[model samples]
Target chain A: MSALLDVQSLRVRFRSLGMLRALVTRTPDPFIDAVCDVSFHMRRGETLGLVGESGSGKSTIARTVMGLTPAHAGSVRFAGDELIGLSSRDYKAYRRDMTMMFQDPVGSLSPRLTVRSLITEPLRIHGIKDRNRRAEAKRLLEMVGLGEDFAQRFPHQLSGGQARRVGVARALALGPKVIIADEPTAGLDVSVQGEVLNLLARLQEELGIAMLVITHNLNVVRHITDRMAIMYLGRFVEQGPTEEIFHRPRHPYTEALLSANPQPDPDAQLARIEIKGEVPSLMNRPQGCEFHTRCPYAREHCRQVAPGVSHAGEGHVYTCHYPLNT
Target chain B: MTQASATQPIEAPAGAVLLEVRGLSLDFGSSRGRVRALRDVSVSVPRGRIVGVVGESGCGKSTLAFAIIRLLAENAMITAGEVRLEGRDLLTLTPRQMRDIRGRRVSMIFQDPMTSLNRVLSVGQHMIDIQYRDKISQADKRRRAAEALTRVGIADAESRLRDFPHQFSGGMRQRICIAMALLVEPALLLADEPTTALDATMEVQIVGLLKALQGELGCSILFVSHHLGTVAELCDDVVVMYAGEVVERGSVRDIFKRPGHPYTQALLECDPGRIHEKTRHLPTIPGSLPDLVEVPQGCIFKDRCPHAFERCQRERPPHYPVAEGHTASCHLLDETRGNHS
Candidate 1:
C-alpha cells in the first residue's frame, strides 16, 4: 500500500525583501530557501517528527503540507492524491483528511466560539448534521480528557492546557487521517504538557492516524514519534527511527540540538557542544553544507563541498562528511 | 529543618541574605472579587545565588517575582506580608524610597527583552537611562555604559552601543537588558523566564552568561521559570508553586533527588530529559490549576495529587519538614511522617 503521506523533493522559497528591493534596483533575485529538497514519507498510524530551531524552515514545511501556504516546488501526495497546486474545489477532499493544531491555543481558537461550537465548526463546514455534530463535539471533548460541561466555556475561560485540549478536539472534529501539530505542548506546564502529549498519543493509537509533529522540543519528539526528521536551514539533515536518532545522532547539528536540552538531573554534565553561531539568515545561506558554519568537525573539504546523504543503518539517513556513533 | 546533606553535588551559595520574603500575599481587585495571585508565599535569595521559582502558568511564580520587587500591577494589592531587601522592608517603603531602590538595587528582567528595553533607544542609551538620575558626568556615564555592555559579552561594546535595540538579535537584546540591569550593581535580580523567548541554543548561552555574571557581580537572582531543567541547571534553591502557594522548597539536589511534594515529584517526572528511554505515556497531573478567584481553602494541588487523601480535602496543611532545609506543604507528607510537629 502507498504510504499515508508521501512528500517528494519539497522545495519552498520566498522572495526575500532584498529580492523585492533588488527588483527596484535591478539586481539579482534574492530567494530564501524556506524548505529545500526535503523528502520524507509516513505510513498510517505512524508519527514523523520535524525538529528544528526557529528559522530552520520547520514551520514552513508544516504550513506547506497543510496547503495553507503555496509550495514553490515538489509533490505532496496524501494517500496517492497530489496535494500540491490542487484547485480550491479539488482541495476539499485533501482538506477534510488533513487538519492542523497550532502552538498558541488561544490564538488558534476564536474568542466568539464556545467549546461545543468551536469543535463542531469543522463538522459544520464539511456539512455534518447539527445533532450528530454536537454529539461528536462532546465526544471529541471527552476524548481529549475534558468533561461535557466544558462545552459552554469560551476560549478565554479555558486554561492553557484546557485550551490546547480544545484545539486537539477541534483538530479531531473532521476525523482527519493526518494531523499536523506544531509545538503541541509548548508554553504549557511540564505536567500539563504531559497531559496534552498523552492525549495526542492515545488519540493516535485509538484512531490509527498519521501525524507530523513539528517542534523544537526533543523531549516531545522522543516521547510520541515513531520516525523523525531533523531539519536545518530548510533541509532534512537526518531521518531515522526515533530511538536510533536520539541515542546515536549522526549529524553534528543533531548533537547540538540534543545537548541543548538541559538535563533535569543536578549531576548531569552540560558541556553544550559549542555550535559556533546562530542559524544563518535565509537571505544569504552559506554555500556547500548549510551546517558547515557551526559544525565542530568541519575540515577543508566541508567548507568547499557539501556531502551527499549517507545511509548509516536500517531506516537511518544522514548527510555529514564525518558521521558520529558509527 | 535539617540542611541538605554535604554529599549533595550542587552546594547552596554561601552569600549573606540579600532579600527575604515572608507570608507574602497579593490579590488583584476585580468586579467579581479579588483574584488571589499569591498566598502566604515566602522565598529568600542569598547574595550571589539563584533561587528558582518554578510552577505552571498562573501559579503565582511571576506574581511572586513582581511582589519581590514591589512592582505588581496597580490593581494588585499587597494584602499581607513583608518583602525585605538587605534587612529593609520594601512593602512599607514610600514611593520615593522605592524609586531609588528599584533599578539601582533590585532590578527585574522580564520574558520579552524587547518589551522591557525601549525600541527607540540605542543600546548605549538603554544603560545611560538607568543611570539618568546619577550625578556622574556624561563621560563617566558613557564609560560605565561601555563597560557594562562589555561585561555582558557584547563584543566591541563601545561601537555597538550606538546601534538601536532592533539591531541586536533576540539573545543579544536580552544580554543588553541584563547589562542594563547590572549597570548600577543591583544586589538582587528578578529574572522571570528571561530565556523563554529565545531558541534552545540561545537559552544555553544566556544561562551560561547569567551564571558567569552572577558569579562576577555577586548579585542574588530570583530566577523564575516553568522549565524545571533550566532551574536544575542554574538555580541553587528551587521553590515549586502550585495554584497560589509555595508547595515545595529545598536545595536543587534535595528537591531533584528526593521530591517530598507530589507536585514536585510530578514536575520532575514531567521533565522530558529525565527519561533516558522512550515511554508510551507520560505521567500527568490529572486536574487543572484551581480557579484563583475562588480558591479552595484545603490544598491547592489536592485535586491533582495522586497521594491526596480525605485530610487534604478537609484541612489546610502547613509546611511540614521533609529533610534538613527541605519542606513540603502537603497533607500526605504530614501523614506519612505521623508527626505534625
Candidate 2:
C-alpha cells in the first residue's frame, strides 16, 4: 500500500522574549518546541486516530500537515511527493488535494455566507469557474445528509449538527484525497457524536479517502479508527491496531488514558488508574520520556533515559521502557 | 439488583432534603412571543447527596440551575413552580430575601470559571467580598478563604490568593471558583458543568474534591452535566432530561442496567462502549431536538424514537413506575398496564 500522507521528524518552535530588559534590548529570544520529532504515516482509506490531552501538540501537527505552519525540521510527503519544499504556486495546487475540518464548526464556517457560498468558495478559489458550481454545491450538501434548501440558509440559521455537515461539505468540495479532522465531535451530544462518526465512516468508505482524526475521546478511536496513536507532549508514545492497543495496551500512558475514560457499564469493575499532577508545560518539558513524570510504572531508568520505539507485535510499536505484561 | 438496606437510610450527618423543586416551568419571552424553556420539571436534592442532572445542551439543565438561584435574565420568567430550600419556598422570596439566601444558603458555580471569576479582582478580593457580606470579620474572612482554598487542593493557597484570575490555569481557576462557592458553606451547591472545561485527569481530581467536600460539609449538590458516564460514577441519583422534560428518574444502577424510556435506551446505546461488544454499527437517535416554541403536543422524543406508536404522537405518556424508586415517562412502560398510582 502506498502512503497517502507521510510526516517525518516534524518540529515546530515559537520564539518568546525573555524577562527583564529583553523586550527593550530585543535579544535572547527563548524558543518553545510546540512539536518535536513527531512522525506518522497515513495510507489510503485508513483512519488514524491521534489521541492526546490538551497541549499535546496534536493540533500543531495537524496545522503543519496543512501547510498553515512551517516545520522547523523534517519532511512532509504526500503520494511520494515532497510537500515541504513546494513553492507557493505549487503548494496552492497541492492544497487542492488536501483539506482540514476545524474543531469548532461554527467558528470555521463564516456566519455571513450561506451554505451554498461556503461550500462553493473552495471551487471558486481553485478556478472552477462555471455555472454548474451552484448545482455542485447543492449536491455536496445533499450528500452530507442536508437538504438542498439548506444551501440558501446562513450559518447562524443552522444547528450545531447542520453546521458540521456544512463543514464536511466544504471539505469535500474539492474532493481531497486526505482529510484532517480535529476534534470533529468534541462538544456535540453523544447521539450526535455517533451520527457524525457514522457519517465520517460512510464518507470514508464511499470516497476511499484517508483520514487523520485528532481527538481526546478514546471511545471514538475505538469505534471509528483502523489504527491509533497515543501522543503526549509532541511525541507518539504508542501506535498500533485499535483492537490490540485497546485490549493489550503496552504503554502505561495508554493504559491510564483508557482507564481514565468513564465506561457506560455499571458493573465493569475495571481498575481506575488516576494520573496525578498536571501536564508539564511545553516550555519546560521533563528530561527523558515526556510521560515519565506521570507514568505509574516508571523506574529509575525510565526517568533517566528516553525510550526508543520498540516493536511489540505485527505493526505495533510503543515507546516505553517497561511495557505492560512484559 | 442489590438494594441498599431500605430500613437503614443512607444518611449524611446533619443532612436533610435541602432543595425540592415541584412542577418548575420557565418561559423566555421576547418581543415577538414566548418560548417555553422548561416544562413541568421536578427534581429533589437531599442534603449531602450528589444528584446529577444529565442532559444534552438546551435540555433546560442550566436554566433550572439559574432559576433556583433566582439569577434568570429579565426576559425570562418562572411561569409555574415552587423552589423550596430547607422548608422555605424560594419562589416567594423577594430580591432582598434572595440576596441574603444566595451565598449563605445556596450558591452556584458556573461552567466557565474564567468568565465566572472577576478578572479585574484578585482571588482574595472575590473571596473577601463573598465573606464580608455575611458579617464575618476581615481577619476571619481571610482565614476562611485560605482554608477554603486549601480544602479544594490548591497548594500555596495563601500566596496564590493574592494573584488575579488570569494568573491561574483553567483547572486552578475552577478550584478558586470552588473555593468561593465553599467559603459560605451553603446547604445546597449548584455546580453547572464544573468539569466540562477541564482535562480528564483534572476532572477526576475535581470530582473527587467535590465528593470529599460533600462528605465533610454535608451539603446537597445539584450537579448538571451532559456526560452520563460521569454521572454514573459520581452521582447517587440520575435525572435524564430530553427537550426540557424529565424522561427518566432513578438510581444510577437501575437506570444504567434497565432503562425503560426509549430516549434513555437510545442515550445508553449511543455510547460506543455499550455497543462496542456488538457486531452492529453504533445506533444514533435520529433527528435533532424539537423547536421549543412549537413543542410537540405528545412526546418530545417521538420524532427520533424508534418505538414510536400512534398513541405516542397523539398524547403525552404519564410516568410509570419501573422499580422501587425508578420511573420513566414513556408509552412502552404502559404496555404492562400496571400503574403504580
Candidate 3:
C-alpha cells in the first residue's frame, strides 16, 4: 500500500536578527535551522510517534507537514500527490483532506464561539452550506463522548477534557485522512490523557486515518503508537516499531530519553541516565551530529562526521556511529 | 562536589513529625459562588523524609501548598483546618509571625522559575533580598548566597550570580529557585513541580540535586508533582489526591503495590509507563472531575469509580485504615470489613 504521508529531506530555517553589533553593522543575516534533513513516511491507519525534547524540531516537522509553515527544502507527498508546490487554492483543497489538533485546546478554540459553531466552523469554511452542519456537529460531539447539550456551551464552560473533545470534534469536521496532533495530552490529568489517547486510537481504527503524534513523553508513544521515531535536534535518531524502540533502542539519544522517563512501577529500580549538559541552542548547533554534544557514547567520529541512516533490523533504522545492540 | 560526596546516604529520620496538616478545607468565595478547592485534606511530613503529593491540575495540590504557607489569595479562605509546623499552628499565626516563618521555617519553590524571580533584579540581588531582614551582614549574605548556589550544582556561582534571570537557562533558573528556597535551611521545603518546565535530562539532574540537598540539609520535603515516577523515585510517602480530597495515603510501597482506592488504581493503570510489554490500551477513568462549585455529596471519585455502589453515591466515605500507616477514603474498605489483617 502506498504511504498516506511521505516527507523527504525536509528542512525549515528561520531568519532572525543577530547581535546588536551585527544589526548596527548591517551584517549578513544568520539563519537558525529548526528542522534539517528529516524524512519519514506514515501508512494508512498507522500512528507514527514523533518523540523529542523541547527544541528538537518535532513540532516544526508537524507544522511543515500540515503546510501551516512552508518547508524551505524537500518535498511532502500525500498519497502520491506532491504537496510542496501547490497553490493557495490547491492547498486549501489539500487541507480539506488533512487536519491538525494543537496541544492547548483552549488556545485552539475561540472562547466566544459555542461548541456547535466551533466544531462546524471547519465545515463552514470548506463551503459546506448544507443546513445539516448543526446535526453533523452534534454527531461529532457525541462521537467524541460529549452529550448533545454540550453544543450550547462555550469553551470556557467545559473542563480540560471536555475542551479537548471539542478540539477532536473540530479536527474531524472535514473527515480528513490524516491528523497531526502536537502534544495532544501534555498538560491533562493521567485519566483524561488515557481517554484522549483511547479516543484517538479508536478514531484511527474506525476511520483508518493515519496519525502523526508529536510529543516529548515516551510513555504516550509506547502505549498508543504503532511505530515510533526518536528525534534529536532536527533529525530522527531512531525509527522503528514502537515495541522494538521501547525494548531495544539502538541510538544513545533514544536510550537516554527512555531512561529519563519516570516509569509507573513503584519498585522498578529505574537507573536514570543523566545526559550531561543542556541541549545545544539551534542557533549554534554543534558540528557533525546534532546530538553528538550530549551523546553518552559519543566518539571522535561522531563529533567530526555525521552518521547516515543504518538499518538495525527488518523495520528498525537508527542514525549513530556506535549503536547499542541491546 | 565529587560523586562520592554526592552519593552520601540520606540520613534516617530522627523520629519526629516536622509538619502536620489536619482537616484542612479551603474555599474560594466570589459573587458567583463558593468553590471548594480543598476538603478535609490531611498530610504529615516526618523530619528528614520526603512526602510526595500527586494529583492532576485543580486537584488542590498547589492550593494545599499555598494554604500551608498562608500565601493564599484574598478570594481564597481557609474554611477550616490546622497547619501545624513543628508544633506551632501556622493558621493562627499573625502576618508578622508568618513573615518570620516564611523563609526561616518553611520555603516554597514554585513551578515556573522565570515568573517567580524578579526579571529586573540580578540573581544575586534576589538572593540577598531574601536575607536582608535577617541579622546577617551584606558580605555574609553574599557568601551564603554563593554557597547555596554552589550547593545546587551551579558552576561558577559567583560570576553567574550577577546575571539576570533571562540569562539563565530553564534548568539553571530552577536551580537558582531551589538555591533561594534553601538559603535559610528551613525545616521543610515545598517544591511544586520544580522540573515540569525542564527537559528529561534536566529533570533527572534537578531530581538528583533535590535528593542530594535533602541528604545534606536533613530537611523534610513536600514534593508535589503529577508524575508518579518522580514520586516513586524521590518520596518516602505518597499522598494521592483527587478533586481536592485525599483519596489514598500510604508508604510508597503500599500505594504502588496494593493501591486501596479505585481512583489510585485507575491513575496507575492510566499511566503509559506501566504498560511496557505491548501496546495495550490505557484504562481511562470514565468521567471528568466534579465541578468544585457544586461538588457531589458522596465520594468525589464516585462518578468515575468502577467499584462505586449505592452507599458510595449517598454518603461520603471516611478515611479507613487499610494497613499500617496506610489509609484510603473508599467504601471498598467497608467491603473488607474487620479483615484488616
lDDT string for model 1 (B295-318, tens) is 896778888887777778877777
- Chain B alone vs. reference chain B, TM-score for every model: 0.93, 0.91, 0.93
lDDT of 2 by residue, B244-321 (tens): 888888777888998888898888888886766622256788888998987888888999988887878988886787
Off by over 4 Å in 1: A18-20, A128-131, B1-14, B332-341
How is the predicted docking of candidate 3 categorized under the CAPRI scheme? Answer: medium
Per-residue error for A154 in candidate 2, Å, reads 0.6
- As a TM-score, model 3 comes out at 0.94
lDDT head-to-head 1 vs 2, winner: 1
- In candidate 2, list every pair of residues with a backbone clash: B48-B220
**All candidates: TM-score:** 0.94, 0.94, 0.94
Give every collision pair in model 3.
none
Pairs with backbone N, CA or C atoms under 3 Å apart (clashes), candidate 1 = B2-B324, B2-B325, B3-B324
Residue B14's lDDT within candidate 1 is: 59
TM-score, model 2, chain B versus true chain B: 0.91
Per-prediction interface RMSD?
1.0, 2.0, 1.5
Poorly placed runs, candidate 3 (over 4 Å): A18-29, B1-14, B135-140, B334-341
